[model samples]
Target: MTSLTRAEIGALGEQLAVEHLRTLGLVVLDRNWRCRYGELDVIAADDATRTAVFVEVKTRTSDRFGGVQQAVTPDKVRRLRRLAGLWLAGQDKGWAAVRIDVIGVRIGRQRTPEITHLQAVV
Candidate 1:
């Protein structure tokens, strides 16, 4: 298969992440939600737990910089939190809890893309 562009890779990674979330029974509320502060890659709700999960997707062809786990720095987490808050502010529904999740999608290394999910990341 041909290599995908960076933005295409990102979009594919997010699509895979959404499928993963659905498999876990989370209802996808929004995707690519943006604000002046930043963008939220995925916004999902766990109705069973009454929680809102904000996901950040990082798609890489290689780990030259760092692994997916290492890609999210403290500063990035803070920014994601702020963006999540902005998204929540526009919602009429209330959630008992809010969480930040990171999903790393590694592609072109195998027959299928690899996904790693870190939930409730601080």
Candidate 2:
């Protein structure tokens, strides 16, 4: 088997996160939406709540630095909130609610990948 590069692993993690969201009945709006600030890993609408969700995905090969979720610091949360507002401002449709989410993906050798989703991060 071949080892994956950091970018490749991150892409895979985002893909997996999208799949997980779809399974939860959320419709994906965009992926890797970027602007001058930064990138939004995933944007999805939750039909049940008529809410827009801005997702930040963090991927890790190991917990050497910390868990993937730990990467999303207070500063990162602030950035994501700003990006979410930017996204909403550019959209024509108004959402009843908007929130931020974080998806952490951990990949390990010879094991299935682990995924954790935290909603309303900010």
Best by lDDT: 1
Among these predicted structures, which one has the highest TM-score?
1
Candidate 2 positional error at 68, Å: 3.6
The residue-by-residue lDDT of candidate 1 on 1-122, one tens digit each, is 68778899899999999999999999999999988888999999999999999999999888897887799999999999999988888999989999999999998888899999999898
> Candidate 2's C-alpha lDDT?
0.89
Off by over 4 Å in 1: none
Return the TM-score for candidate 2, rounded to 2 decimals: 0.95
Each candidate structure's TM-score, on Cα atoms with residue i matched to residue i, is: 0.97, 0.95
Clashes of 2: 0
- For model 2, residues 1-122, the per-residue Cα lDDT tens digits are 69988889999999989998999899999999999999999999998889999989888787787875688899999999899999999999989999898888888843887888998976
